[model samples]
Target chain A: MANGTLVLIPTPLSGQPLAFSHPPEVLSRIHKITDFAVEKLQQAVHFLVKTGHPVPEYKMGFHPLDKHVTGEQLQDILAVLQQGRDVGVLSEAGCPGIADPGARLVWLCHSRNIPVEALVGPSAITLSVMYSGLNGQQFAFNGYLPVDSHRREQTLKTFEGRSANDEQTQIFIEAPFRNRELLGAMLELLQPETRLCVCWNLMADDQWVVTREVQDWASASLPENFENKPAMFLFLATPRQKAVSGKKSARSKSTGRGSRTTGTKKGLHRKRYNPD
Target chain B: MANGTLVLIPTPLSGQPLAFSHPPEVLSRIHKITDFAVEKLQQAVHFLVKTGHPVPEYKMGFHPLDKHVTGEQLQDILAVLQQGRDVGVLSEAGCPGIADPGARLVWLCHSRNIPVEALVGPSAITLSVMYSGLNGQQFAFNGYLPVDSHRREQTLKTFEGRSANDEQTQIFIEAPFRNRELLGAMLELLQPETRLCVCWNLMADDQWVVTREVQDWASASLPENFENKPAMFLFLATPRQKAVSGKKSARSKSTGRGSRTTGTKKGLHRKRYNPD
Candidate 1:
């Protein structure tokens, strides 16, 4: 018998209606899967119940998928797949395998040649990038900043330099309570012209995403209820003027570069040219 | 009157069923927005028609959103928004403001403090990372590489070196026709231990995502229908052991580092540890 597919399922970002965070088709398609590896069992059960999954919460197999998830536990889930029963991988919030522990399970399935499918859904990282109106063409998600004060300051300066040099957007997240501190430190340490974006309560009724230069942000006041809320922080430094380099400058985009229109008869059209 | 909201809408990846690429809720929510800034007019018309938008495609407003889109065109769109009518931004494929020209419009909105909403949807870049089973926590999307062969070769080596030193998953895209050529160059250029992943025809009937070491890929045969398909290529060089440097190694994670469980009272839990 063929091994069953491993489906990566994304959960809601908040307690908002399912329609706001997921497409109905994804919910319907994954409803039949009786096996799941989830970040937190209670959260997954609540999500399933909210989505009206036909199976009773007690009937489905729920395996812990946190850092402590053991190899033997993964083997057990793999055994279920080998027995021709599909298993779903669900993260606490957002798409599985991106900034979550679910990647370990997906990696395991790939090593064994078991097919893996990642469904379309919301990601805070992706949404924050979009809402920030920053450089999405070239960006990096650095997960979390160093907790230490001195190190975090140095890291911020380094990221700002890299961003200015490469024109790449730098993204990272902070725990809700510590967000204010991070912002405060950013205002104090980052360059005056650096742009900073704070995205809070994504997909919620009162979702907020704002961007401004560090100088502007220094004078602005954050929302009253900004603390204790899920947030994503992003920054971009003003791109520096091209320095005179001896070797062929790799940063030059004088050559045409644009999106490749796939499955179109027009083939390739160089529509955009962004200068350094 | 308050300025209208700017909604970032993602289009389908292929000629596949709408249900396969988008959730019903997103289509429904966006159906009533008659004003749009799209990469191409015909493509947006087809997507709206297929999704069963009630209005006639000809009747709805369509503005070109390519590089050629002028300041006057954007001013017209902004005027409509200032008139309190929501306008949608649609890319050729995937999410708007991401690896596309929609970002320029988005930046315009941000400069004016116009509201922007990013709905949940598909992004080939995000999906490829999830399916690659690579490091999604710390990854960078470098858009496209230099097209010149010599520069392209040097860029590939630079990306590989960065990946090894930073433990980052390096991602880039190529025109469908040139994907095979890119893979050929990667095989000859990347180190033996570096892992490479090719994700082609995402969300299609025969979607293929496979990751193998450079040595392994050197001996494998690609699928026959791999050419002329939308694809994302990713590679990760084996992370070199931490070098003993005079200054403190910046990459050290001796302290805790993990996801910040949002909206929950549990605060922070440092679960996983990935050593250098």
Candidate 2:
């Protein structure tokens, strides 16, 4: 028997009752769904209550990372589909499958020939890109880098090589605890001038999206409350050169010296050569 | 005086009737909008008629691209904002400021510190990425590569470098007429097995999104009737090189010279390795 449709639901941001981008109408439709897979049943219940939706009395299947998703779990979800029930999947917060665990389910669904429909909604990745003013043409998302220095360095090198060739933007994330360490590594490895866009607490009232050179970031003091906050780091290669070194000189010129002084004697001379 | 809010209106695909994403309720809310800067005035008039909204009889200003957008034009738009009137900027299709000419107006609004809000709607880039199944975390959106071979090669080289280091996906569009030429160049420059996702006439009934290896694409005949058609090309670097290569080799060994004779031997060897 053909399994039911699997609807991937994106949860709301922290402290915000509304799911990231989904409107009230879409949320209402999702609430009425009878069969579903949720990352956490308790959180799902809380969300429904806060949003003022009647939580359906369903023994929702759980997809916990520590508990390996067994064949029985898969069978139960499939049975819901076989019984003509539309199964919905919800993430804790933000869009599913982007640096989230929903990817495994999405891939499995695709492999099993099940149809997957992704409704448009709020994604920190998209919103960050929009506000960053970085080149949106080509980009790579490397997810979260390894915490170990050696492994992280190897990963960063791979990202650097790719950015050097194509001038494409590279997006990666780090655990809040290791944010300063990762940022420090990036500043040392990447060109001093490489445009880095950091999106912290996106879409929320306290959101901060800033694009700055690596050297500037290195010099500035780290945020006090960055310990447990979710953050996204986006790096755009210098327009002229794909190599990291090329970006260093460009960065110094563009932000460091360029913005400090007016068009005085030396400024006139600099303007003639570098009219940035 | 504080400039008025810039209402960024996303026009429909091909300026056709019923192509807009915004409904009547949304349009009605912004009815007091006076100043207008559109790609084409006639298309704007057509949109108003198709939507059946009350048209403002005021002599609205039109800022066409052919004519330089001077300070006067900027002032005229700002004057409406000063008088508490909202200024609307519309594009030909899809989202404004995304591979569209309306970016200049958006930049102007940003520079003047005017509030700019982008509503959720159909964006060719976002829609293409959603369907491609490629990495959506990091991406670059280079509008259109130069038609000149030298410049095109330079751009491709840049894309290659980025893909290598960051494993970022690179997206670029080509003039409808030169798509075949661009594809040819991509085949020659990119690795034989590099993946390319071609999205043509996206969201329309005749839309097509195909992911294929560069070498395979080269061997196939060029697509017909692509002239003047809107298209987006996405290139993603394959991660886990050894695994992919191993699979390719195994497939070749089975399908090529040894298939008939070695089939039984391979089956026995596989059975011995996995007793289950």
Candidate 3:
């Protein structure tokens, strides 16, 4: 019987080594496996070398997404599994099978009943949610919106409608070049008071996570060099209610049931907004 | 200028040894940090001792959430902070201000502009998302849903509507006793075809992470022993599209975009359902 492959090891973000602290241990275990698939052979080699634990001897199976990976490369990976050798897969950064290009391979592994174990680690998605201060309970993460204006607008409208009724938080990302344009479109289309958060260069020394009202964002002049920067955007469906002060009144019910309330609050101001 | 009086340190889930992780290093940095606002004073003390670190000679401040933390105890924490002494806030598990009980204090710090720096460590949210096989680009982490049937239903409906139109993923949690009940409710109220991923006892020896269709879930009865177990629930807005087979034909378009047409073959008996 063949040993199951463990795929999807996440690497740390740039300058944020602590995000995924388990990769080293995971890599060590991979060395004991007979075969291994890596997103980028060179990058993986460098990582192993830097960590002082290079793979001694094993079959190298590069994934199709890697520059060195090809149809033949995939076959090599499958052949290793067929030979009953345990296989391990690792991504270049953060989590595998995310925006990263390891999904197809992982899916193939899943279909084959290969045992896949994903270790816990840091992810930009969770970090962004933690700092956004938006509704965390119900959120949808839409990956990079289409570059085309028509498709982009359609995507934005779709998210807008989703957040219209419930206090759902909608998450999306855009290539740095199109961020400003996307923000502008959001300002024009989304409810003026909808809450929006932008987390840029997260976990790095220059990380910036800021939340503001959509209208406030619309009115601000675009930064001069707004192109080519990686960024994540979070939009809250319901306007954050101002936090209540003072003691609970006699009329305050403990049932904790609350309805959706809406109103336009002016430009980004830090205040507690929990209608409940 | 008075130096910042607040330090936010993230503890591990199992309260394991720190070794050389970021949390302990941050804990050692405070020069005048006299009072430590810990969730569990005895556990924190035991952890500090087990890590072979010198027990700080400073006074200990415990939060009310701790077995001994109370309103009066919180006032003690505030008093120490007001006296210009740095106060370190630690949670019983995972990172502070995230699904943990330190957020109210963090809010107090934010309101007062008391500088707050969060050190990194193990986070269940980050771990769960890493394995969810859902869109990671945008997500919301609603801590735990209300236990009441009406309120819980209302909250679920609100969350469901948020991701209906986009590829956003929504995440929520429930106490151990209500896990099966909540899962049952979710299967009924959510789109039957929506994909659901559940991570139970994350990072522990018996950890289980499963992503399955809701309909598939409805057909089977879950074991009752899961009550009181810590579990994280992730619902993707849509099922990811399968990759195109290599034999598919590529069609050229006038708009310079190429389209691939492939015939779908039925092989595996995988369930088909739209998460939306």
Candidate 4:
């Protein structure tokens, strides 16, 4: 028998109705799968139940999947697929196998020639980029930075250097409780002209997405309740296009070390738009 | 007056029904907006009509937006927002401002303190990471490489070096016409054990997402019609985790230059699963 497909299902980022983030087809797709490997069983059960899955939670196969998911545990999931039953993988939130676990299962299916289908849904990282107003053409999601203040400071310097040198935007996330710590370090360590974007409580009624230069943020503050909510932080230290005497152009500063000097001098005026 | 929100709308990847990739809310949201800045005017009209917008194509405000969107043209869009009228931004496909034009506009909105809202939708980059089954926790989308063969080769070398050094999954794309050329270059240039993933015609009936070592792909061929479709190429040159005596753990290889050597030897057996 042909191996069953492994479907990667993305979940809602907030408590909003599923329709807010997913189309009718995703609802129908969820109804058909009876086996799952999820980041958290309770959350998966809750999401499936919310999706109106016909199967009771008691009868469905729920496998545990986290960063530590083992090869043996994965084999058990593969055994179900080898039996020709489709298994859906879900993250606690957002798309599975991106910032979440279950990638190993997806990789395993690939090795064994099992088909993997990823359903479209909300991804905070993607949303952050779109809302950031930063360079989306080239970017990196560095995941999380080092927790030690000293190491994280060093890492931030490296990321900023790359942003300028490669013209790539750097994106990284933090545990909810550390949002403030990260923001503080960024303001203190990054160059004054570097753009910093903070997106908190995405897809929520109280969501806030803001971008400003580090110098501007030094005096401003995060939302009072932002510390506990999931957030994504991104920055771009790349210089803006060289300013002309008569007109402004949309081109980016060219890449490499020498452009850094030109970018720093001209990029400051990037935030200022005067309708001459 | 408060500046009107700059809504970034994501479009479908293929010609499938809007229901296939977006929810009812997106349609409603599109219907309420009359002003738009689109990558392609014809495609935007087609999409708006498909969404069943009440306004006639002739009656809507459709401004052109591409890499060359001028500071003057953006001033026009901002002028509309300044009047407390919302303006929607659309890419030819997928999410706008992400490997697509319009991020600068999004950035402009941020600079002006205009509320920028990015609705949930399909992102090929996000989907590629999810389906690639590579290291999705950390990844970089390098957009496109140089068109010159030699320059592209050198950039690929740099990307591979970064991937191995930083444990990052590198994502990139090519013009559909040049897909074959890029694939051939990749096969010849990348190391044997590096994993490469190709996702073509995503969200379409004929979509294909596959990941395998460079060695494996060197022996295979792309789908016959893949050359003409919008495609994404991703690779992970990082070494696999250190092999245990009797078990395969899910831990990733550590970051830094030293780990590269350890990753090389142990990673060769990564694809082999002895279910003993």
Q: Each candidate: what lDDT?
A: 0.75, 0.52, 0.53, 0.76
Candidate number with greatest DockQ: 1
Instruction: List, residue by residue over B221-253, the lDDT tens digit for candidate 2.
Output: 445766546667777654433321122223223
Question: Which candidate number maximizes lDDT?
Answer: 4
Report the C-alpha lDDT of model 2 over A145-260, residue by residue, as the tens digit. Answer: 55556656766676666554555567766556656677778887777767676766664666655566676675455567765566778776554443332322332243222211
Model 4: per-residue Cα lDDT at residue B226: 64
lDDT of 4 by residue, B14-115 (tens): 888887789788788888899999877888888899889999988889788866677899999999999998999987888887877778888888778788
- Give fnat for candidates 1, 2 and onward, in order: 0.35, 0.06, 0.11, 0.42
Model 3, span B82-103: residue lDDT tens: 7777777666666654554454
**Chain A TM value for model 1:** 0.89
> Which numbered prediction scores highest in TM-score against the true structure?
1
Where is model 2 more than 4 Å wrong at Cα?
Answer: A1-11, A14-20, A23-33, A40-85, A102-113, A145-167, A178-194, A212-228, A241-276, B1-119, B137-229, B235-238, B241-276
TM-score of only chain B in every candidate structure: 0.89, 0.75, 0.72, 0.85
| i-RMSD of all predictions | 5.5, 15.7, 11.6, 11.1
lDDT of 1 by residue, A119-218 (tens): 8777888788888878777788876676677778877887888777667789877777778888999989988878888899888877888888888886
Q: Determine the C-alpha RMSD for candidate 1 after optimal superposition of all C-alphas.
A: 3.9
Model 1 chain A: worst 10 consecutive residues (lDDT sum): A263-272
Q: How would the candidate models be sorted by lDDT, starting from the highest?
A: 4, 1, 3, 2
DockQ scores of the candidates = 0.41, 0.09, 0.18, 0.29
Docking class of 4: acceptable
> Which is better, 1 or 2, measured by DockQ?
1
Candidate 4 lands at a TM-score of 0.87
**Top-down TM-score ranking:** 1, 4, 3, 2
Docking class of 1: acceptable
